[model samples]
Each structure stands twice: as C-alpha cells, then as structure tokens.
Target: MIALPFLKSAPPPLQGERLYLRPPQLSDYKAWATLRAQSRDFLVPWEPLWAVDDLERSAFRHRIRHYDEEAAAGTAYPFFLFRNTDSRLIGGITLGNIRRGVGQNGMIGYWVGEPFAGQGYMYEALRLIIPYAFTKLRLHRLEAACIPSNERSIRLLEKAGFQKEGLLRSYLKINGMWQNHLLFSLIEDDRWR
Candidate 1:
C-alpha cells in the first residue's frame, strides 16, 4: 500500500486562474444538489444511472463518506470545482482507481454543470489536477476513458495532451447499458516531450 502523507487531512485546494478544486464538504449539499439537479439532462447520458435518491442530502452524505474512505486508502481524490470569482459550484473532478508501486497511475474523470459547459473550466481543472497527480502524487501515468460518442470529452482529453490508446469494448455501464469507451492516456514522459 502507498503511504499517503495527507491521510490525516484533505489536501489543500488546487487553484487556477479562474477556478479552484477542493474536497467536498457536507455544507455543499445544497449547491451540489442544485447543480446536479439542474444538469441532470446534460449529464445523464454519460454517467451511470442515478439512484432514486441520488440528489438527496442523505445520499450525498454517503457519497462523501465513500470519498473520504477512498482518499484515506490512497485510491482516489475527489473534488468539486468552484468558480474563483463567484464561488459557484460548477462541477466535479476525480483522480480515482489509483495503482501504486509499479503501476503508479490513476484514472481521471469529470463533469461540468450545463451552465459551465463549453466555457473552458473543465480544461483548467484538468491542467491543475494533472500536475498534482504527476508531481505531488508521484504518478507516472494518467488515463481517461469516454464513450465513443462523447465528442467534447474526446476534444478535452486530446487538448490536455492525452493520446488515444484503443477501444475498451463494453467497458462500463452508463445509463443502465454497457457501452464501449475510447481509452486515452498520458505518461509522465509525455509531459516533457
């Protein structure tokens, strides 16, 4: 198991020019529920099927507990994105399923509220997390997979310097169905190339 230095406390917020990322807090339930509720139509296609009480405060509390456990285990870092100017909750991003030792890699995933979509916020979030993963976390590679139909995600990953790897057949269940995903990856060496 990897030795996580921040096990005692959550990592400090990551700052960007116009956005910031910090771990989810219980107090954020209202904002989080509002955003997810408002963006449900936009997000449903790419995400897993939402439970009946997905937006409920109790469900969010459970999600937070799961996030805390993952972070403590050094297997995931979950964050909520907030606009620096207005402090509005805009989206979320995660570096999850981490593999330590020889693997030294993790998976990247994200979602932007509909209002914040197409505005470059997710890209900025990616820029911040990439360095945090590669440098602070000492990870050697980062991977992301998106449904083949997700053009925006493809563009985002490509713009962030991830190269298309291959197709993952029936890779994940999204919206109640198994879907194929295109794999993309960036190695530490790619950063310096």
Candidate 2:
C-alpha cells in the first residue's frame, strides 16, 4: 500500500464551470441509482455486466467503502459527477490502478447519465481531471481503454490529448462478453523525455 509521499492526502472536490467532482457518499445512492437505472440501456453496452443487485442500496454502500479504502490507500480516486446548476448527480469517473515511483501512471474510467451524454459534460470533466491527475496526483502518465466500436469515447480521449497506442485483444469482460479494447495514453510534459 505504499504511495508517493505527495499524494498521502485525499483530493478535494474538483470544480468546473458546470459540474463538480467529489467522492461518492452513501447519501448519493438514490440519485446514482436513479440515473443508472434510467440510463441502463445507454450504459450497459460500454460497461461490465451488472450484477442482479447492482443498483441496490446495499451494493452502493459496498462501493462507497471500496472508494474510501482506495482513496485512503492512494490507489484510486473515484468521483461522482454532479451538475452545479441544479446540483443533480449526472455521472461518475475514476482514476484507478494507480502506479507510483518511476511509472507514476494510472487508468481513467468514466460514464455519464444518458440525458447528460452527447453533450460536452464528460469532455469538460476529463479536461479538469487530466490536469489533476498530473498535478495533484503527481502522475506521469494516464491511460484509458475503450472498445473499438465506441467512437464517442475514443474521440473524447483523443480530444483530451491521449494518443492511440495499440489494441488489446480480449482485454476486458464487458457486458457479459470479452471485448477487445483500444489503448490510449497521455504522458506528462517533463516526463516525456
């Protein structure tokens, strides 16, 4: 559970013009469950198959504990995306699988509610998080993976300065099937050399 000395503390809420990213809370279950339920069809194709009780409050409580432990261990930071205009929950994102020392790398994963998708909310969130990844988290590289058919996510990563790296065959089990994924990465400026 060792981590770089700098990231010993948990990060604060990251604020953007329209949204703010903060750690998930138990109280967020209702809003989060509602959004996920409403966006089930929209999200399932890109995500792992949901368990039978995926949207249940008890499951969400477990998630909150995992998030807390990961954050405390400096291994990952999970965030619930909330719209500032109405303070409504819109989505979530995480910087997970963090590696420190010489690597200083991590993986980014995210999803937006259906009604909030297609717009630039995720893009803005990415813009905000990437810098935080490099600065606050002191990471040198950030990676993301998406299925080949997910053009929107690929485009979003490209827009956020991630370079297409290569393809990973049967990289992850998604939506009840093993899916190939395209890898993309961004490296911090001074570390690029």
Q: In the order shown, what is each candidate's alpha-carbon RMSD?
A: 1.4, 2.4
Count of steric clashes across candidates, in order:
0, 0
Q: Which stretch of 10 consecutive residues in model 2 shows the poorest summed lDDT?
A: 1-10
Q: Pick the candidate with the highest lDDT.
A: 1
Tens digits of per-residue lDDT for model 2, 59-135: 99999998888888889999889999998999999999998778989999999999999888998888888889988
Stretches of candidate 1 off by over 4 Å are 1-4
State the lDDT of candidate 1 residue by residue for 1-193, as single tens digits.
5456854456679999999999999999999999999999999999999999999999999999999889888889999999999999999999999988889999999999999999999999999999988888889999999999999999999999999999999999999999999999999989633
Look at candidate 2 and give me any clashing residue pairs.
Answer: none
Candidates in order have lDDT scores of 0.93, 0.91
Clashes by residue pair, model 1: none
Q: Report model 1's TM-score to 2 decimal places.
A: 0.96
Residue 149 lDDT in candidate 2: 99
